[model samples]
Target: MLEIKDVAFGGKAVGRLEDGRVCFSPDALPGERVQVTVTRETKRFVEAQLDRVLEASPRRVKPPCPYYGACGGCSYQHAAYDYQVELKTKQVGDVLGRLGGIENPNVLEGVPSPLPYGYRNRITVHRHGGRIGFHRRDGKGLVDIEACLLASDEVNKRLAELRRERFHEGARVLREHASRMGFHQTNDGVGALLQDAVSEACGSGGCLIDAYCGDGFFAHRLAKKFQRVIGLEWNERSIAQARSVAHANESYIEGDVAARLAEVLEEADGAATTVILDPPSQGLDVQVADLLRAYPVAKIVYVSCNPATLARDLKSLAAVYELGSATPFDMFPQTAEVEVLAILRRRF
Candidate 1:
């Protein structure tokens, strides 16, 4: 018997097995009593597959998608959308306290996305065994899907066209961007809220140095608010596009920000600046944090998707900067993914 006490960060239920070993059961909800079959086991913990829910929580609901359990697309489909946000908010606070060594950090409730369903602007589907669809929960095999509920209507129509066009490649990618299919927010509606949150965190002033800035999304808007804006990205195509629309005060540089950050800071010449970091899911290196520590940058507005690495980075940065409240945004609903925006002001 397993008593699911709470839900973990990756959409698994935190529970203890009969042998007192901590067990995680996938596709589970908190407050549920269940019998599980152990799939994998370690010395400290065990991973189990859900067998049967002897007692279900009131918040547990029937999943909307037919392939909810099989397809790796949606993890929280069995959870109510409001409950999903609540779990994510709690998870963010837990990580901040446990990993970041922050005692009772100011963490606000997660902001829900404007459109939860049908919000993804891009997706890459796999083609295997005559099935053109997504990967399974284990991320090994393909799950044949007729349609994806998370994709936009335009993307779904394109999926249908791809099926009819005999485009039976190993994978099919869907993108909303006109120029090139690169990295952009899958949920653009919530992305606006993220931009607003970052802007609010920075509070309108100083040089906006947008690291990993793609197509000048944040830098262009902040150029008017600041004396100058510098966007650094490795993508040459995105840099070209950004340069084409650059204002007189805005400049986009095509290079690795990490290598050129010190040079850029030297050029800034001790001006008040906010270094905006929107890194990938892998977070950033300790060297980046070290540079921020040595530099005189006034503020840092960090946008992150992975909390574990975010906590690690914040812990390192805490020695130099004063940590502020962390705000989470539900950029991807019905999934384990959560977007977090954290602000750190320089300590005197």
Candidate 2:
């Protein structure tokens, strides 16, 4: 038996074996004693499979979904909604402090989803042989699911329709929300809160440079706050969509952000500029960091889905910028995935 002390960033509860080796188990919670069998072992840590809950936590609750343990889609169904948010909030702070090398990072409480279950606007299911559903929790094969508890009603209805039809061995994406533009957030409720945070961070700037501005998600909404708004992205399709609803003050360029950012930064006044970075899961490129350091902006609002990469990028910019606030958005509620908005200001 091991006492689970904390939940790690990647959705595993951390505990220590009798020999002092760190162990990770997915179906366990903090403050609980669990009996586990080691599945994989490394020099640094051990991965274990939870066999039984020796001492259950108060936060543990009956999972509503019948396929909760079998399906790989959701992890926190057995945990209370508020406790899930609390665990994720701590996970963000832990990752930032450990990986980013920031002492006592300013991490705010996680913003809870309006509806924990039935919040997902879309769900992707795979079909293999006779099974048609998501991958198993162990990831060895598919687990046939009648319906997904995390998916919205409309998405579930489409899923039901897909179940009746026969398809080749592949994946099917059922979505309720429609976006003509590219790369919109999956959770619409939390997505609006995310935009609000970004807008607040970009308060009253003269020039706004939105890097990796897919479909001008922020650029279009925040054009009125700045005298000039420039959006940089590589996707031509997204740029076209952004251009279709272009504000008078907004100008979008279709090119690599690292290649074109310097040219725009050279012309904009550094004191009056606020650059918004909504990079991919890998975070900002090294060249992009170098350019930002060379040409410092007044403020930066970085939006990231992966906390580890976000921490690394924040550390890279620590020399020129000071951390203002870090807010966690529970965009993907049931899973361990978290979205963070980090605000930074040029150091005096």
Candidate 3:
């Protein structure tokens, strides 16, 4: 029996074993005593399987999805939606402090998703051996599913149509609509909040350089705030789309960010320039970080999907930038994933 102390960043509850070794288990909540069987043992910690809940937490609730445990897509289904946000908010601060080495990180409350379930606009289901669904929790094989509760009605309708027919062994992506080819956030409502946060941080500037700006998602929205908005992207399709709807003041460049960012920064007004970085899960490239430090902008609004990588990059930029605020958005609720927006100001 172990007392679940805290829920880690990956939605796993952490506890200490009787032998003083740390133990991690899923499907367990903090403040609950659970009986677990050791599955894997390492020198530092042990992985366990939750056998029984000796004491359940008040935050625990019955998962609406029938395949909650079996499906690996949603981890916090058993946890209350509000509690999940709270945990995510705390996890951001914890990760920043632990990984970034920032003392007493100022992490604001997490912005919750309007619709906890049925919010995803897109999902990819794997078809293996005539089974069409997501991978199992253990990731060993695919679980045949009829409907996904997390997907929107439109997406679910497409999934139902795909299920009725037979397909070969491959992954089929089901989306509500045939949007332009590029990356888009699965949750629409929370994604707007994310954009608002980035926009608010950007405020008004002489020039806006949106790095990794896909289809001018933030650049176009924030174009009015600046005399000119320049967007940088690597995808030819995304750049074309961004230029198709480009405003008189907006210009998009297609190429590697590391290669083109320096020229964009050199041309922008250094005193009133603001750069919005919405990089991939890997965070900023080493060259990009070095460039931002070399050419300090007035402000940098960073949007990240992975906290660990965000924290790592923030630590690297501490010398040139001072963190103003770090806010998290529960863009992907009922899962371990979170989107954080950090605003940084150049240090004199």
What TM-score against the true fold does each predicted structure earn?
0.96, 0.96, 0.98
In angstroms, give how far residue 348 of model 3 lies from its true place.
Answer: 1.1
The list of candidate 3 runs beyond 4 A from truth reads none
Best by lDDT: 3
Alpha-carbon lDDT, every model: 0.85, 0.90, 0.91
Sorted on TM-score, highest at the top, how do the candidates line up? 3, 2, 1
Please provide, for model 3 over 1-348, each residue's C-alpha lDDT reduced to its tens digit, 9 standing for 90 to 100. 999999999999999988899999998999999999999999999999899999999999999998888998988998999999999999999999999989999898899999999999999999998789999998889989999999999989998999888788899889886774787777989988888888888999599999999989889999888899999999989899999988899999999999999999887777789999999999999999999998999999999999999999999999989888899899888989999999989998
**Candidate 2 vs. true structure, TM-score:** 0.96
For model 1, residues 1-348, the per-residue Cα lDDT tens digits are 788998989899889876788999887888889989999999989999999999998998898888888998888988888999999999999998899898997888899998879998888888888888998998778998778999888888877877777765598787766456446778999999998888777766668889888888778878788888998899988888889889999988888877878778877744488889998888877667788888868888899999888888889988888778789999999989999998888877
Give the per-residue lDDT digits (tens) of candidate 2, residues 1-348: 999999898789999998899999987999999999999999889999899998999989998888887888888887899999999999999999999988999998889988888888888889998988999888889999888888889988988888899888899788886554367777888888888889988997599999999999889999988899999999999999999999899999999998999999999999999999999999999999999999999999999999999999989999999888899999887887999999999997
Model 1: runs farther than 4 Å from truth? 269-271
Model 3 clash pairs?
none
Counting only residues 3 or more apart in sequence or on different chains, how many pairs clash (N, Cα, C under 3 Å) in candidate 2? 0
Name model 2 segments beyond 4 Å from true.
Answer: 179-181
Worst 10 residues of 2 by lDDT: 177-186
- How far off is residue 160 in model 2, in Å? 1.3
